[model samples]
Target: MIKLLIADDSALMRKLLQDIFVAEGDFDIRLARNGAEALDLVRSFDPQVITLDVQMPDMDGLTCLSQIMIEMPRPVVMVSSLTAEGAEETLEAIELGAVDFVAKPSGAVSLEIDRLRPVLVEKVRAASKARIRRTLRLTERVRHQMRSAVTARVRPKPARRRPVSGAGKPKQKPGPSALPGLVLIGSSTGGPAALDAVLPSLPGDFPWPVLVAQHLPASFTGPFARRLNSECQLSVVEVGNPMPLQAGTIYIARGDADVVVAARATGIIAMPAPARASYLWHPSVERMVLSALECIDAERMLGVMLTGMGNDGAAAMKKLSEGGGRTIAEAESTAVVWGMPGELVKNGGAGLVRPVDDIAEAIVELVGAHASH
Candidate 1:
């Protein structure tokens, strides 16, 4: 049985979560009324995984999480509200080493939480198996502290910018000479922190336009894109509508839907589409890769599978490799959950396997070589 500790300020929420896990028949559970109680139990109970509620009394989830990570690091999943402020807090928790999160239904005393049973159980199970990298967390902690001050004073507001062509669609096709190589990235679970490590490493003048499909709820993607934009040299924007793809910019696929790339008459465009019944994960990586392949030649593409909990991109990336595209899988040592990338490596899809820190360097080398040839 998985040893699990659940911390929440609300008694109802604590019991609701406990009942969900108890029904699984595979978890040994403990409950904490707040972050302080949770911290106490972390030592006495020594649980394998923890589920933290963000708005706990006495000590908030963020403060408690920082201590737990520093004192006795373990896998944690934050139970967050589905609000903009909650999204920001959850992302901060992830950067401080939380493995994953489940957004609680909006409102107090929500029976709607029943809808999240599968997601909560699945993420907690995944968290139990996740690795905690102290070095990475410490490095992020310092940098996050530095950025916090600057960001608080002048944080960028999230907004939807008009696409290049004032029209809803591209008007005129740019010539083949305007086409640039594309890098497609798919991630989940430990994705945000992994993306933070990799994207910022690319230089300001990096050649290809990068696209990322990360599993998230609709409320979270805009803040996530803005957060990355502040940290990285390249501009980062959420693909809310059809936007022309350009080098030196990173497009984060909008959440709660699939974002696909299509060759428009004007140029290449990235746009959000309805989530297809065929794809299991939102912001579906599989759908994105297949869609891009339909328009862009595999030779002009690159597929990257980072730390995530499932085989979302494995098959399509394998096809990309077979069609002459390059692919990279995050090494087992660095991936908090190696499911996605591990599947790629196991299936002979990965052209290279590198730890998270080295991925940017590999991309630079490979893309530069492709550019030269």
Candidate 2:
């Protein structure tokens, strides 16, 4: 059975969540009223997963999270209000190693409770099996430290210029019916929402195979892919080793593996990292982009970086831009947390920065233009 601990100051919230999991009949649930209580349970119970609320009288979720990671690391799902401040703190918690989060329900207890059931259950299950990484805020001091460490460890590569062939270039072609060469996407913190906005826009007849690397946990990817497949026009599935790439399909990397496109005669194959090779976080955006750049021609690749935290994709996006791929970043106004895409823009790695809605349209336009050519 999956062992779970629910930490929240609100009795109603705790009871509501407990009921949801109990109904599922697959979980062993524990309860904690505050962060301190939760920490104590964690040491003794050693639960497989934890759902920690943002606000608690004894200790805040962030403090508890730090202690949890330092003492005994496990998957944690932060529970927060839907306010702007809540969102900010929730993102911070993620950076501190929380796997995912669920927004606290609002309005009438009955109405809100029902609305949150599905998301809560899903997040709980995902958190139970997620691989969490060590995270630090991307402050100037932290960046300086990282830069120094990187500089001391490795030599910098020569600067490369962004390719301009596709810029303002009209789509011309042998015919209007050719298939898409490749589809590359990057996503971070708010990637799920961004993807929800974009993936469904592609028609069922889309000719390109889609590749996505979302910064998420292993447990989340499977359910996430399934959810996308249900909503999207195309078939969406979590990628596994030796899976053949096909048009009208979306492949999400497993949460514990790097998603890479491997070259093949018919098309690219989805390559997942071996278990031993898995990073603390899987579906690494950087590794995915670099591998895609090496496997496919730039002109044939469509690279997109969506809302996220951190600069994980910035360096690889530079390669994509230089390789003549069409690279796009999520615009700041629409991002949940602008850290990742912002870094790409600051580094001049993005060819275009567009809002979430426009991203889908832009992709279609680019693909259409490529087909025409």
Which candidate's lDDT is highest?
A: 1
Candidate 2 ranges with C-alpha deviation above 4 Å: 1-179, 275-281
Instruction: List model 2 lDDT by residue over 210-300, tens digit each.
Output: 8898866565677677667666667888986667676767889886668777767655688788533433335788787777777678788
lDDT value for model 2: 0.73
Q: Which residue pairs of candidate 1 clash?
A: 172-266, 173-265
Most accurate candidate by TM-score: 1
> Which digits, one per residue and each the tens of the lDDT, describe model 1 over residues 135-169?
47554473454455467635443232232111233
Error of 1 at 30 (Å): 1.2
lDDT of 2 at 93: 64
